[model samples]
Every structure is written in C-alpha cells, then in structure tokens.
Target: MAGTPSNEPNEAPSSGADSAISNEKNRILVSDLMGDEREVFLLFNGSEYRLRVTNNNKLILTK
Candidate 1:
C-alpha cells in the first residue's frame, strides 16, 4: 500500500541556525531594509547589487 499525503498546509522548515538567529537581537527587518519600496540597491566591496521582493513576497538579490 502507498502512504497517504499530508493534509496540513506546507510550512517553511526550521533549522538550528534559524532558531539561533531568531533569538539574536542583531537582526534587521526586511521591511526596514526596503523602506517603503519593493527594491533597494546595495553596494558591497565596490560591486552593486539589486535586492527586491518578488510578487510572492520572497526576496531576490542580483548583481
């Protein structure tokens, strides 16, 4: 017999690092980073990059 699929909604899997990072106070919110915009430009090590929130509310960073 085959196993049945779960009926519960899928959720993001949590890892040890996720718990540790959530407990730390040195984190910044994504909303704060975007600041009323869906995208932001970042300059790191003399290279420019683009950070943006996708339509599905996920973040994407590109050079």
Candidate 2:
C-alpha cells in the first residue's frame, strides 16, 4: 500500500541541491571561482577567467 503522499504538509523532503546540477568544479576544476557568465569584467591583469553555463546544461570555465 502506498503510504501518505510525499506532499503531505509538515512532511517535506530535506533541503539540498539536486545532483542533476553539474558540479564538476568541485569534482574536476582545480583553479579558482572568479565569477559567473552574467558578470562584467575587463580583460586585464595576469590572466582573465570566465564561467559559462550553456543552454545544454554544460558548465565551462576558461582562463
């Protein structure tokens, strides 16, 4: 028998992020977290970094 529906009030699931989100940075990248794509930055200093979340749900970080 199916117990009370999961949506029962006062009985919600724990708060956490979905694994579907690409977390390769913590699982792959070994650099830095400069900023996201929507940020505005001038190309200067020793090196420039950029983070992009593509429409295909892909996370790309470049320097």
Candidate 3:
C-alpha cells in the first residue's frame, strides 16, 4: 500500500449545511471562553457568525 488509512474511519463527508461550514482550522485565543470543554469552531458561508461545539456536543453562536 502506498498510503496509510485515516485514524478516523468513521468520519463522514460534510452535508449541504455542513459544506457551508469553513473547513479551515482557526486557532483562537479565547481567554474568556476557555474553561473546561472541547470546542469545534467554524465560520459559516457569507456570515460573520462563529460556531462553537463543546465536548458534550453543545452548539454555540457568536458574532
């Protein structure tokens, strides 16, 4: 084999709504928001809003 498999075999393709989410990883220094949760941040298409997912899969929106 010329390549190795992905560690995340369960990873699925993005949907139409998910496609609108920015694929880019953003490193944000959130001294205000950081506490004790895992976060998934995304930028939506044509919107300045930001998405934040927690370790518990909770959703958060910020401008």
Judged by lDDT, which candidate is best? 1
Q: List the residue pairs that clash in candidate 3.
A: none
Question: For model 1, what is the C-alpha lDDT against the true structure?
Answer: 0.85
Q: Using Cα atoms with residue i matched to residue i, what is each candidate's TM-score against the true structure? A: 0.59, 0.29, 0.25
Clashes of each: 0, 0, 0
Best by TM-score: 1
The positional error of residue 58 in candidate 1, measured at the CA in angstroms, is 0.5
Q: Clashing residue pairs, candidate 1?
A: none
Per-residue lDDT of model 1, residues 1-63, tens digit only: 336678776545668787667657667899878888999999999999999999999999999
Better of 1 and 3 by TM-score: 1
Local accuracy of candidate 2 as per-residue lDDT tens digits, 1-63: 367566655533545565334443346442343343443333558777666666885666677
Q: In candidate 1, residue 37 scores what lDDT?
A: 99
RMSD of 3: 11.3
Q: Judge candidate 1 at residue 16 and give its lDDT.
A: 75
TM-score-superior candidate, 2 or 3: 2
